[model samples]
Target chain A: MVDTQWPVYEVFHQQARGEPHIHVGAVHAPDAEMALVMAKEQYCRRQACVNLWVAPATAILATEYQDGDMFEHATDKSYRESWGYKTPKTIKTSDEETSK
Target chain B: MATMETLQDLDAPLKSAVIDLLYRLADDAIIIGHRGSEWTGFAPILEEDIAFSSMAQDDMGHAHAFYQMLHELGEPDPDTNVFGRKLDQWKCASLVSLSSERDWAMSLVRKYFYDVAESLRLDSLAKGTLIPLAQLARKLSSEKKYHLMHGHMWMPRLGKGTSESHQLMQHAVDTLYPHALGMFESTDADSLLDQAGVCPQENDLQQRWVAEVDKILSEATLKVSVQSSPVYGGRVGEHPDDLATLLENMQLVYNLDPSAKW
Candidate 1:
């Protein structure tokens, strides 16, 4: 008969430095301050964690699985990998040959 | 060493008594934890909701550990021990089986009262004669510290919040105080447990619980008239009607096909 329930918040946790924040779970809290505390206790009790973030679940905009392919790339983005720059190695070798 | 050997040699009566006590402990945790978990998505705040859910999980975990010990003693598996038992067969304290849902104040007050009683009981069990149970009791005692802290931190804040909040909390305390006092109900095997050094004096435990809770309530500027005639049916398996409904809900999936493994 009473409205005592609070809002739900999505919890993201970063386990260590340079790590991506992963969605661990959700918790309901009346406010942001309380949500953070609950997230720390519920999620971080067993392991190390550098940081935690709590956002209202309703605030996040998410793409549906049906539209996931809309963001896929057609180009071969080989430049993103370390092995992609084989031309640099060849150029360095040519410079050394010319110097010799 | 002699004491240790004596304790290790648990005769049939002592074994039965220990099993009985363990069932009471495990069942109390299971029922209360289940009830508390109902607040999962519905606490006063998101933080409190999460915190309460975590506490509920811890309570259930503790019950599982106790059930494991009982299983070693040739009792039913943890699942059966928890969900398969008839309503009248559950050995939890009456306080745990009270249906106080949708009432945050009552939930907190009930939890506070139960935590105090559980902490004290576990403290006594930590010094028990049985080595395995004593070890488990010690571990559980640490977990209860956080539960107590959670209740203590919130009782005052919520008790003195808005007028509506304050009224709700006070009314909850008033309603649950008697059943909360039922936490101190004397188990049938208390004499055996006392003689075997399995638990400490009940009066001393009750006094300690009262003193600790009274101090906390007084600090919060809240007053409760401690009820003398506390309800007592849980230890012997007599429960309120709410427990039947609760068990039905909990066991629904399990009961669908008991022989089928999910």
Candidate 2:
């Protein structure tokens, strides 16, 4: 039994109320309760923690790391960023628009 | 029974009994804390290594709290009392000092047994009539819950695992049950403490502990021989050579620089 290592659970830690549960680390445990125990001890020993969440590593879906180019846009996609809306547009009345 | 609200309320005999009780609690924590700390680099899994180390720190902190209480009762400071004591001076049961030799099953069994007893002891002390001790016990009682949770999680998993694991857990339970009984080894202080409404009799607590632990053992599919007699000695300052060696190793670093501050 050199390699009967238990399943890994991805640990998520919430620092405080209204904060997102960020992926802290992973721990091997037989189940979720044990995973929580392991995750708290391993990931939150020195950090401020309000709560924790653990899901089996298998449950988390992710894009392949080799597909990095999928996230890189060949064209600029400034519409996705708040900075692209920095300028206020001038509103013209219907009459002004017709005169123009 | 008069309530001891403060140190001044303790008479001579009661003070002695209280000191005896404190030594039992403090020394057991110190010894078992060392045992848990030994698993720092050797646990079956990395998660367990960290968990055991964390428990070790909690045990040491509980020990320090008890020793502080002892110091208030006219004993030495916490550090001096814990680190300067010899083997026989320590009142920890031999169970905590039992040689695990890096056996994971043995260590888990020892910790599970000790945490059960410690939880029961803290609960009783917390509900007792001694104001100061009850306060400390109530605080320590909260931390014992996590240790008990750890114990509950692992015991059943190992016991109901493969056949070899089943055998390993059974062996550990059979081997350590008697020593666990040694945890409740009674003394003259029992009567004194009982009379003062401070804590229950050791035997009473042991019966309740057995009943409670029996359910978990059942779930673990392990049977304990109830007829096993306790190997009692540590309560009265009698101990094996292992304790001396443990104390020596535990104090070696401090001895290297007696005058240096951490």
Candidate 3:
């Protein structure tokens, strides 16, 4: 079968002004204008939406799933943690040092 | 004159004219909505598929609003008025009922023309003396604002896009322009609607529509001939055979079980 669909566009919409535009969904369109219209109909029509944006799916730079483990924490890094610095409340006194 | 806020404000002839206007409004919305929805799965692209389908839903909702208004004036419920009516009883303009050969250009032009007319009429009603229609028009215009936007987005793109596309769009306009003009075909209620201070006659609406359409089409590099005769008779319920076929699909489920709550 032939692949007859247009390019995909990632959709982001904001529920209010000065708010973040969260990723709502994607649509297939020839250009950003149609993509914006599509994003509106597909994602914003039924919801409380104040604004929308559409970018070509090809324009997105994404990490591979196989590289997902690269985001995990490295071992032997506990020194940076707050628990690593935890200690009893003790003062270093000259008397204690002399006794030692 | 004061606004006619309810059905009681209408005398016998005035009520008849009002119902006539309502039927035309509701019928046009329903048929074009049905036609637009045929592109649901088959549009050239998925986004447009969603767009057309979305507009179709809006049109249907508008139709429902008109039907509900008619019900307030003693017509049947929306479903029965839509599904139970015979082919000859339909008052939709021929432009809306005309079948497409799965042509996107035809669909776009038809919707563009109809929606523009709808928006203009809604504006007239929104400011008219029929208080209920005015209220409904004001409410529906918000949704219609986007629909007109969609038309603006596509008309120029397809008209100036490619040679073939431009020609296809031109052909679509030239072919459908007459039918579109038919949308304002004179009806018995035109005089009454005017006398009732609802709005000007349909021909005046048609003139404004043509001017608006002309300006937009010029911007899009498309043209419609003034010499083309308007296809009439839809206002009086004479439609092409396609309406019956379209209705068969539209009312298929309803015809199966009119008693069903769905």
Candidate 4:
């Protein structure tokens, strides 16, 4: 095995037209263009892809999983989610419903 | 230039010329792909192993495409063309026939030279008069663009790297230069292919390749010899003993049952 490892580049791929680029995997490359090319050969060769992007792994700012408190909320915020809403049975009247 | 669209549309002489060119292209890809795959699981790092392995598959795929084109021209299937033939029957360049051994620097340098020549050849073929071959070359060239990137990225690193790496790279370059030059050895079909605009002359491609490789080597501060003799003859079926060993190992399984579905 090679003793020295090159820098890691995180690869992202857009599956088809009008699709968001999703993180697929990573590959080692000496530079950006090489990274993009390697990412294509490694990740997109077997599947269809419209576009690809690569960034140095070290360049990404990541939140650690151990920091659970950063995502915790003291108060209920269910209103922000669709599951919080209940079914409304009926409308009283066209005038009343349109009023408020 | 004649618009030789398909095998059926070609005259006898032109068809033979085209098949000769296809054999050269296909054999080079297959042999080099085998050499590259030899580095699998043995590269200094895991990622490099994966990278080389992936590119090997690309090389084989390109080879398969060329072989399929040959099949369309009335040659045997891809498997027989690859495994059924004797060692001297191959049309690969001597550069691709030599082993890379366990030296990563040598592999990189050899591939760098091979990749440059292949890129230039494919570029010419992409504009070829043969429609089916032209379309195939255009598609395969897109894939080869990345391979060139792989070579360009690594050659500089190895050339300008630390003392040991730089020494290794320079040595490999000096040693492999002749074999690399052999890649442009002119075949009897060259004039026919050139006249028909089916492909560029080897000399022309060689000139462009020299300019491109010279620029890259200059950027890397590596010195290329001006007076080394090229090791030719692979195009006409002559090859080094290394090719025999390579074939023995490559065809070990396929030779057992050439007709087996695997």
lDDT of 1 at B50: 69
**Local accuracy of candidate 3 as per-residue lDDT tens digits, A1-100:** 1254778889999999999999988887778888787788889878899988888999999999999999998787889888987564465465577789
What ranking of all candidate models by lDDT puts the best one first? 3, 2, 4, 1
**Candidate 1 lDDT, tens digit per residue, A1-100?**
2454778889999999899999999887666766776787878878788899999999999889999888997899888998887667888899999999
- Candidate 4 regions with alpha-carbon error over 4 angstroms: A2-9, A27-38, A64-66, A82-100, B259-262
Stretches of candidate 3 above 4 Å error? A1-7, A58-70, A73-100, B256-262
Task: Compose the digit string of candidate 4's lDDT tens values, residues A1-100.
Answer: 5555778899999999899999998988778887876787678778999899999999999899999788998899999999998755554465577897
TM-score against truth, every candidate: 0.75, 0.89, 0.87, 0.89
Error of 1 at B210 (Å): 1.0
List the candidates ranked by DockQ, beginning with the highest: 4, 2, 3, 1
**Regarding TM-score, does 2 or 3 come out ahead?**
2
Whole-model Cα lDDT per candidate?
0.82, 0.89, 0.90, 0.88
Off by over 4 Å in 1: A1-39, A49-100, B1-8, B226-228
* Candidate 3 lDDT over residue span B35-133, tens digit each: 988888898866678778988999999999999989988999888999899998989999999998799999999999999999999999999998888
Show where candidate 2 strays beyond 4 Å.
Answer: A1-3, A69-100, B1-3, B253-262
Candidate 3, residue B43: Cα displacement in angstroms equals 1.2
DockQ of each: 0.20, 0.38, 0.33, 0.52
* lDDT at B36, model 4: 91
